[model samples]
Target: MNRTLYDLAGADPALRFSPFCWRTRMALAHKDLPVETIPWRFTEKERIAFSGQGLVPVLVDGERVLHDSWAIAEYLEETYPHCPSLFGGPEAQAVTRFVNAWTDAVLHPWVGRLVVRDILDVIRPEDRGYFRESREKRFGVTLEAFVAERETVLPEFRRALQPVRLVLRAQPFLAGEAPAYADYIVFGAFMWARGASAFRLLESDDPVHAWRERMLDLFDGLARRSPGHEV
Candidate 1:
């Protein structure tokens, strides 16, 4: 099958950083599917205009075109049932929905506050204006102002992760012993931070940090091999 993923990238082109795109990338990897990833920038909406939407992680798998990370995951699960399950079973898939929602609603906002400013440094200069204007209009502040108090709010962000920490304390992954779509949903946020900033979001001793390390090591360090900061 010819699989292509229009993934969000930075100025370097190799620097893929969108949290949603990471989710899809990790999902494709989890399914052991090989893909050709195209570097997509914010200003290059025309590149993906055929997908009928602007945002990427737009996957063209065979004759099917899909978008939205969670929707893409479900599509992969159903279309490739014989492949390793992205969601272990129907019951697990049902619960994974909550993880997906929490990551999108709570985790992403917190992470954005921490690293959205740094993203300006990584994206192409042409895209920076659009990124800044859009994000600042949404945030009602400049990128620097939005993340200025990250140090002060760091504890709040860590505290918000208690639910995830509690779970990781019991299992190797959010999806249980082995990673599934649930793990990827959360891991994608960290990947965004990794690709965009040098700031550390988790302490070395933190269980969440440990889980991220394991996640990075998965699939022969697929994520770790990507261009990103060590943190």
Candidate 2:
């Protein structure tokens, strides 16, 4: 409905594929909301840093600027209320919030560590040592030590998700039979830290893997576009 914001953000700003960015892009694509993308470099810190809280995927909506994925999701939901509700239903909104929060708190950190383990191959060779070293500094351990620590955290994540398995059977999306804001949020986080990072921890024939495919299918254009093509 709002074409001006998309018009201004016509270029893909960031070179990296962030899950949060992917989620917002997919959200817009799903609803057929025409928003343009501004691909930003990490070096362009001043502009986006001030607005997006030092992050990518900041939506320039005409005069209004949206920061954070949650805020963006809420904006889209409110802006396009009729287009296949992202919240799915009134009750499911709470579920979406929980799942999104869960991904941030539990899943993301470990995924980040796992990603840093093999950063040497992924990033520029010059940045490799720093990337690997940052994980050590953050986790207070080497890759081997971090992996052991990850095992401890991952089981809890896997277990916490245990209760949701049953609900998932009936409701393909996290909120219910349909997808919701939370599904997009969690899906984006996972897609970024795991999918984009291509972390080994995420590589499995697990339910989460299955869940990823299911969530993407809930939307239209995003599901069709290969990861990291347009938005």
Candidate 3:
């Protein structure tokens, strides 16, 4: 394939579940780009060694290789100007960067606290030791201990989502009327949770939940068709 993406996956190869990868996937769909995605596992770092990194969401387009999801999105926007824009304009791109940073720093950690333990069950058997050790070292605690109070902390996660909720309450999408990179940035976290855990992260009446439903319905149920919980 001319355009290929190494997407993080679970034991089931069809389960492409990385939040970062989801960002890239949504960005690609937004740009009206076609890509062949290869399912990748955590322990398979060497598989993506060509990108000079261990992370998935590696994109190889023709001779150019890109690793970071944000970089890949930018590349797509610049390369395919004729296609739909991921960010509306320079101003939109600047604001979307803040959304990206927030998703990485605040939202991801909250989602991780809720679903990190459950991730072990979906990952490949060989990747289990590496995942647990790496995650434990990063968090300085065992997986079970890390997510032990997921139920109690669910409220905190929901509380942290107030910013997005507030924005959604006013606008249909983070980038105004139409979805953009900002929407993908936040929705990626929800996709991560949906793919790995059965946890209900939002309430039915929540505006955030409504936004997520619209996101899942995008690209003709691209995300909803994935193997994940209804919530």
Candidate 4:
């Protein structure tokens, strides 16, 4: 198909998982666009080099080439205005940016510390060295050292989710009655952890967990059907 997405995969090609990629996937689904996702591994940077940087979630919509999940989401919204709205309006779009930034800056990193080690075990063997080298450089610490105290710090990570819990307590979604780009932005991080590790990030009774269940059930169980941990 002309619409293609280079999605990050584990040793099993079916195991697609990357918070950023998941955002694009959900955006495409939100826009009712069909996409052919190509499984990509860490060391396979050359495969997506045409995008001008190393990353998955690269969108090739016919001749238009795009990278970055947020950019892709905007493109989809603008390109397919006839489709269901991903962002409700300009104000919502602007607000969604805050959600996107918080996710990329705060939630992603926190979840990474919890699941980064598990990722190494699932990635292809050949990609392990590259993953370790790159991650260590970015984190400035060995993976083992970085995640050594994950259990001890679990409470702190959950506490960081208070903002989301607060929102869900009042509305069914971060964007209000229905899911929107903002919801997808936050859910991507959870999908990342769910895909990589079986660790329980949210308590079963937590409002966040209830919201996650609602998200997973969206688009007829699209995220839930993906190969990943039940969490």
lDDT of 2: 0.58
User: Between the candidate structures 1 and 4, which one is better when assessed by TM-score?
Assistant: 1
lDDT winner, 1 or 3 = 1
Point out the higher-scoring one by TM-score: 1 or 3.
Answer: 1
Query: Number of backbone collisions per candidate, in order?
Result: 0, 13, 0, 0
- List lDDT for all candidates, in order: 0.95, 0.58, 0.92, 0.92
Best by lDDT: 1
Candidate 3 colliding pairs, count: 0
- What is the TM-score of each predicted model, taking all chains together? 0.99, 0.71, 0.98, 0.98
lDDT by residue for model 2 over 168-208, one digit each (tens)?
66667666656656667667655554323443444356666
Q: Write the per-residue lDDT of candidate 3 for residues 1-231, one digit (tens) a residue.
A: 499999999999999789999999999988888999999998888899999988879999999999999999889999999999899887789888999999999999999999989999999899999999999999999999999999999898899999998999899999899998899989999999999999888999999999999999999999999888887
Model 4: lowest-lDDT 10 consecutive positions: 88-97
lDDT of 4: 0.92
Pick by TM-score: 2 or 4, better one = 4
Q: Stretches of candidate 1 above 4 Å error?
A: none
- Considering TM-score, where higher is better, how would the candidates rank from best to worst? 1, 3, 4, 2
Collision pairs in model 4? none
TM-score of 4: 0.98
- Write candidate 1's Cα lDDT for 1-231 as tens digits: 899999999999899999999999999999999999999999999999999989988999999999999889999999889999999888999999999999989999999999999999999889899999999999999999999999999999999999999999999999888999999999999999999999889988899999999999999999999999987
Model 3 TM-score is 0.98
